[model samples]
Target: MKKVKKIIWLIGLIYVFCAMVNGDAVISSITTEAETTPIEDSASYLPDKEGKENKITDPNNMGDSKKEHLDSEISSGHIISQETLNKIYEQNGEKVAYLTFDDGPAPGVTPEILDILNREEIKATFFPIGENVKKYSDITKRIYEEGHDIGNHTYCHIYKEIYSSPESLINSLKKSDEILQAVLGERYHFNVMRFPGGSFGDKLAPFRKAVNEAGYSYIDWNCITGDGEVISAPTDRLIETLKKTSQGKEKLVILMHDSATKATTAEALPDIIQYLKDEGYSFKPLSQIEEGY
Candidate 1:
């Protein structure tokens, strides 16, 4: 009886030892699998050229790369640097006058204005609305050929349509550019714009940002002839308004209109130019202002 009990005890000990060895082997296999297999990070995966998923080497550089791509795609034909733009806005003690005509290329008025500018030997900037450019392509071409800087002034010049949103304003400017290009040829490009009613107040902040992002610069007038305020204003009143608005400004971006109704502006141009010249101001086109910087 004692011999049989010893045999049973030995067999039970052998079974327990085998079970322990199998459990250790199963744990080792699981650990090896965990170390060998890779866990995917969904955020780190990007599409490869072959349309397969690939891991980004450095996720931090992705934003910068994307920004660079976007910047390269943007057309910066004649975009002025922010520093140069700031100098234009601030008075720099140098007497410079930039005569800018908006809503123009009219039959009689634009020609008269151009003739006066030619006689004075001064080059000015003209912001012709797209509608007017279509109506008077010849005049627009003439203004460009005469060595005047041409800027985009929205398509329809309707405040409600343009001021509805920043996108609306950009679209209008682009549409006007298309019209201008059609008139001026494919080689002609302009990177300057003027907001109708001016880009002022907090309301236009988004529009200003959008314009800059689109690689365009905009200027607002520091002096005005009030031709837009009172269509067909008297020549003397226009001159007086110019004098009043131009007071104490060393750098003047003088605004006037050459729309069909603004014939008086044409009449006032000679006197306005004379006054600026007498004030020791050198006339410059708006496009050339960046060259000094």
Candidate 2:
């Protein structure tokens, strides 16, 4: 009977040892799998300043050091008041030209434009549509790096969608700002914006108020290149339009497009810069004007 009890105890001990080894093996397999499995790239959905959530696709995976550097470069300039903006718009004093390009960061066009501006040693403002910013993030980054001011032109730039209501316009602006932050880092913010198709007339009155309330100062062009008036307008026509519209304007907010289709604008830019220089008008980024206020 004692021998039988001993045998049973030995059997129980072996069973317990085997169970312990099997448990360890299971845990080891699980840990290895966890380590080896690839994590899928998922959208980091985050809320914007307006408490609205937006899905930002971060292509660069910008590091903290780079972000800090960018933040350091950005200046927290004072927001221009309505009265000050009106004063600037009234063409009160200095003969300054604010060259603003809209609807871009185009693949071929924007880089070419940047090159021209670089050669001329002039800085301008670029109002890039959010969708374009995502598609051509590298160009967008280049614009910021090259010391140009950037403004939000809206996410999709669809007129009916954004113009349906004041709330709709505000939401679109917020979404565009989120997209800009995704590419340019969280510290970057555009205090100034230009409404698509110009923020003029009583139709946009509500939107104008909403935009100001949402912490943005909207700018309208007193002059245009008319590059967007026709599909791929001739370089001569663009130059002529600019000259005609800019006549008698001491302070010019010159509107132009830098979309891929508007290559002629790039071609005509050198002449435009020269013409402005000849006309005794100094080129300045829109931000510079705002900063004065």
> lDDT (0-100) at residue 77 of candidate 1?
42
Candidate with top TM-score is 2
* Candidate 1 local lDDT, 48-151, one digit each (tens): 88978764533445688765654454432455554566579565567899999999889999999999999999999999999999999999999988889899
How much lDDT does each candidate structure score?
0.87, 0.87
Clashes of 2: 0
User: Which 10 consecutive positions of candidate 1 have the poorest summed lDDT?
Assistant: 69-78
User: lDDT score of model 1?
Assistant: 0.87
- Report each candidate's C-alpha RMSD, comma-separated, in the order given: 19.4, 12.3
User: What is the C-alpha lDDT profile of model 2 across 1-293, one tens digit per residue?
Assistant: 99999999999999999999999999999999989976446434446788777645342465787555554656433365555666676544678999999999898899999999999999999999999999999999999989899998998889999999999999999998898988988878767888999899998999999999999988888889999888798899899999999999898989999988999999999999899999999988876785544
Give the backbone clash total of model 1.
0
Lowest summed lDDT over 10 consecutive residues: which window, candidate 2? 69-78
